[model samples]
Target chain A: MSSGDHTAHVHRDDYGSRMGMWLFLFTELILFGGLFLIYAVYRFMYPTEFHVAAMELDTVFGAVNTIILLTSSLTIAMSITALQRNRKTLSLVLQFATILLAISFMVNKYFEWGAKFGYGLYPGSEMLLDKPSGEILFFGLYYTMTGLHGLHVLIGIVFIGIIMYQVWIGRVHSTNYVRLESAGLYWHLVDIIWIFLFPLFYLII
Target chain B: MANGTLYMPETEPNYLDYRGRFKGILGWILSTDHKRIGLLYLYSMGLFLTVGIFFGFMMRLELIAPGKVIIEPQTYNSFFTLHGIIMIFLFIIPGLPAVFGNFFLPILIGAKDVAFPRINLLSWWLFAIGGGLAITSVFLPGGPADTGWTFYVPYSIRSTTNVLPAAFAAFILGFSSILTGINFVTTIHRLRAPGMDWFKMPLFIWSLYATAWIQVLATPIIGITLLLVAVERLFGIGLFDPALGGDPVLFQHLFWIYSHPAVYIMILPAMGVISEIIPVFARRTIFGYSFIAFSSLAIAFFGSLVWAHHMFTAGMSDTGRFVFSLLTFLVAIPSAIKVFNWIATLYKGSIQLAPPMLYALGFIFLFSIGGLTGLMQGALSINIHIHDTSFIVGHFHYVMFGGTGFGIFAALHYWLPKMYGRMYNEKRAKVGFWVLITGFNLLYFPMLVMGWLGMPRRYYDYLPEFHVYHFISTIGSWILITGLLIMAVNLILGVRRGAKATDNPWGGETLEWRIQTPPTHENFHEIPVITGGPYEYKINENGQEEKKYEEVT
Candidate 1:
């Protein structure tokens, strides 16, 4: 209802872009939260079958991807610090490291799923479908949750590559870095999802 | 002017008269100005509402006689689906907030536009694109989504229609909603003028804040849930297919987590508009403004917890039923507090029965009945009896259509003049209101009675016992449509040929009324500092009232 000084201030960044990013992250959390809820309910319903299904997933692959995503998250986090400290080249190197880790994570997922498909364990396959319905349900959650996570990792890699391009051209710099920070936050979220997914889908007994 | 060099004439170029970067329709379609975006929403929503009305008309006509009169059972199912989807997503959810909130949120908070102007424009385009996809689904190769708007699990996954595009349409619309939420929350936090603080803001902004949070937090759940349903159909995911060990109830859980609070999203803004209108028309500061404001937050919080009330008959455990039923009742407290405050504000006040005020009053009466019936359904025992019956249908209409629908109607009548700088025929507006009320009550009331008599909903035909009630309801539809035409025609004439509106049309004390009618593109030439509350009508030293708004030096 009240106004401030009538002097026209040229800086129109009344709302910091970082605030918008944080708000967007809230939505991303809820999006995965839905999947987690489905996981919880279905797991409770068929605890024995879910446990059996978890045993079939190769923990070696799950563990390796988790480590890869965790390291990528760290690199992306450090890259923001590098950019903020005005080390442009070091920032780009760290960004490259992060994308490399994301690619390895996806490549690991491909072989794991390829092996499962080799055994005819893919969703709706006769071998899995012929098993107890709980096993089908268990595999369903694993694929949907991990596949959705993979999509995010892929999107995060593209997003970081774009940010790196912006940094190289000086469009993003030490003083102007919300874009890089947003991309970092997204990468960390993808990492955190893996952190949870690794245990719930692969480690849980 | 602050520098004493600039001058503003009474006939300065209004927002409508001013042109932007693009020309012709592109200027409006692509403009980042919040006002123009608001108008874009209004025009698009109006078109969808007409289509929605036609669907409802067909359904009611088919129901006039119990059997198939114009279409078969399958077509009737699709008819209801189209009607529900169009009304719920395209109209009610976005209606008030998108149209009025966009236009006035910045102006009322004393800012030029929302925090992110380009993002605001993007949200509208998303909405239009989402709406277009949904409409296209109606005629696509598969012949529309035959699943009800709820799109309950296995059926939705198994439907032969174009479920993917239709469900994706709602999913894409969620992005539009989420972006708007981020914009509004940031705007209210950052854009308020120097003297304006959280407590000093209007009730409408407070309600929008609550609604925005739900949009931000809860909408994603439904978005992802809908995506899962689409995935199940596309791939045999069996996520919710009972035959595949998937739980159908889980789908309801995910869906209602967003939608249950979505009811508040639909109604809270309407309540805010009524809060604005009642105080202005009654010429009083709102009764317990803080209470009304806090009640909005309360409704948002508790509304989220009560989603399972909709699932009581879906075979939820007894404990879950008990907890959800109690939470549902608790949400009613805040909504009722708002109704009480509006009534208290009107007590012994200089009440003006303008068209907008009449609509607000109608909203209160209709929403109260809706709210009471909601409480009735919230009770586990009562809900079991009326579950899936016409009573549930009646209750939702009283709430969603009667409550939120009339809220939008009231807002249209109230704010159209401010946007266009012209007033509608007040006398004709009153006549329209009376007929609309009679028709609305006639339209929905029998459903409550017949619902108690065990007339099930979603049925294409009914036994002879339910015939009388069905006939009464169809007649009510005719009356309601007649009244709607009158109101629509009156408002159209007001825009085309009515006289100009003054700055302070109803002695409103908000910041928008203090500025030029219809407003300029940048809103204010220079921001004014406030020294008092938004609704105070104070007496000056001469024992007379001062200007409705004043600038502090």
Candidate 2:
């Protein structure tokens, strides 16, 4: 019922904004769902090869990254709570903590992927091309799925960094924190995707 | 306007004339107003439509005599491929919803604008960039994609043409569709007028509600799948390339998964437009309002299950084909319900054969032909027989072009006055309708016959036995383009200088007609409170139906 002006007086609907974020998150899930379907089909087709390839993935690295993502999700959630309590400094600290965890997760992924690349085990690599077709496909899905998931982690870090600044400026605070809350929702989605990716790629065997 | 300050007019101005921070072209493009955004889609779609039709016309001319009249076979391949890409992605997919839905969804529901105005503006920008990339692929080094719009893998991965840009364009467009869907769903859920409830909302809103859900849920699948094609191409990933231990059939499954429901995304909004038009012109309250509303949901829900029907001829298990065939038939029930309701609404009413009503009736006839032919293809045996034939092409054109395209034309005729505050010439509009419908059937009907006679589609040249059909279809293309040109010119002239129109030119009983012509910057001066159905036309003591305005603003 407000005027359709862009900036004179903002029309804020917290519930509507949250609902839109959830709907967007659903689309993100479906986006990853396509890749998951591919993973399932390939896994079913080349069971032995997938098992052999899963054995190649370092479980310790996957487990550590999983813990990192889960903790980042918690810190983002707590940041929302801190903002709700009007503790701006605490909220910013928590957001920065989440961003640090996200960066650490990406760093661990870098060393893991770097180890695989050192073995020439990437899509279209000469060493991979010499392997069995099923094994090649296993590495292909590995890179595509985990690689896409890594991109999401990087995006989450950038998003939280922006929201952290917004909170510092008092634009998003106790009374109006949907912006921070939406960033948390996106960050959680990134974490949940990694949770599924962890078992499917690293622990399936 | 001062820097960093919006220029809010002292008195409310029509959205078309509203001055904002930006001026001229910048104003139209940068403005977050829903009305201006709708016009932006309309104008961009107009440009794409002309280019797409030209491609179709050239393909038709090349087929007129047989062995390559105008271009080489490779060029012909790019022509149909580009034609399908432009028409499907740029024209029909966003056709009705982007143009009419953006303009009217908020107004029809008695709201100021969509839930997220900036996101809505972003959707249009994505559409433009996606479309630009697609057309720009034509002049790129490798030329436009010849993998067809579906971009079926193996060949798609191996093709030397610019499949990358085209595939990326569709992926970008999918994002735009998803954003629009999110915006509409949020707006409808949160921004309805004070008293308008679920059932009392306009049937068009119901159709959009269904269509928006499909857009949100279905488009992301295509987004990822197309990206997979790009990945497979760039990295030689073994996703769909058979040489790399990939199954090509999987690509078909994933492609149609989104695309099959995408048909609903295109038509459901068109159905909404028809629902709005039929009752207004027939001068009666819509019969079976809930049925029409629910049928839209039914179509959206059932449409997703029937993607395998497209894969039947592509080779799947018998049980899989059987299940998908059955689901395909189930989806038709809702469409039939809508067709029957439109017919019943026409019966025993003061029917005016206005230009919009004419297009509505045309949609019923043409879409029935299209839908019935679809069922014909849904049969396992019949589908294999006509799977890649010209019959499939005919069936698609009948539905996408005849049904949804006509529905868009009807919307233009019905709502353009409200949009531009001017009226198009009625006699010329009726003439345009007749010519277009006549040319339309002439262009497509022969494809059904030729296809039944075993003429395959996507062939550069056909046998001499198919010559007559191709000739007639080509002639029909000429007439159809002429009809299109006539209508385009008439509408353009009308927008420029037609007579000023009254607010409620068609006596529409919806919330839109209750407002000012070419509505103000905020659609309603005061947000309305609705107390009755969208098409509540009461009968007077003189035994004629009269609309009673029960809505309070």
lDDT per residue, candidate 1, A107-180, as tens digits?
Answer: 99999999999978887888988878778888988899999999998999899999999999999999888889
lDDT of 1 at B172: 91
Determine the backbone clash count of candidate 1.
0
Worst 10 residues of 1 chain A by lDDT: A1-10
What is candidate 2's lDDT per residue for B338-370, written digit by digit as tens?
999988998887888888899899999999999
Q: What local lDDT does model 1 show for residue B201?
A: 86
lDDT of 1 by residue, B1-553 (tens): 0111121655457888876556788778878788999999999999999999999999999999877789998899999999988888999999988999999999888888888778888999999999999999999998878898999988998889888998999999999999999999988988887688788788999999999999999999999999999888888976899989888988998999999989989999999999989988777788998999999999999998999898899999999998999888898899889999999999977777888999999999999999999988988998999999999999999998889988998999888878998878889999998998899888899999999999999888999899888999999999999999999999999888787876667767778877777888777777766556777643222433323212212
Q: Clashes per prediction?
A: 0, 0
Determine the TM-score of chain B of model 1: 0.96
TM-score of each: 0.95, 0.97
Root-mean-square deviation of Cα positions for candidate 2 versus the true structure, in angstroms: 4.4
Query: What lDDT score goes with residue B204 in model 1?
Result: 95
Query: Which candidate leads in TM-score?
Result: 2
Question: Which candidate has the top score in DockQ?
Answer: 2
Model 2, CA-based lDDT: 0.89
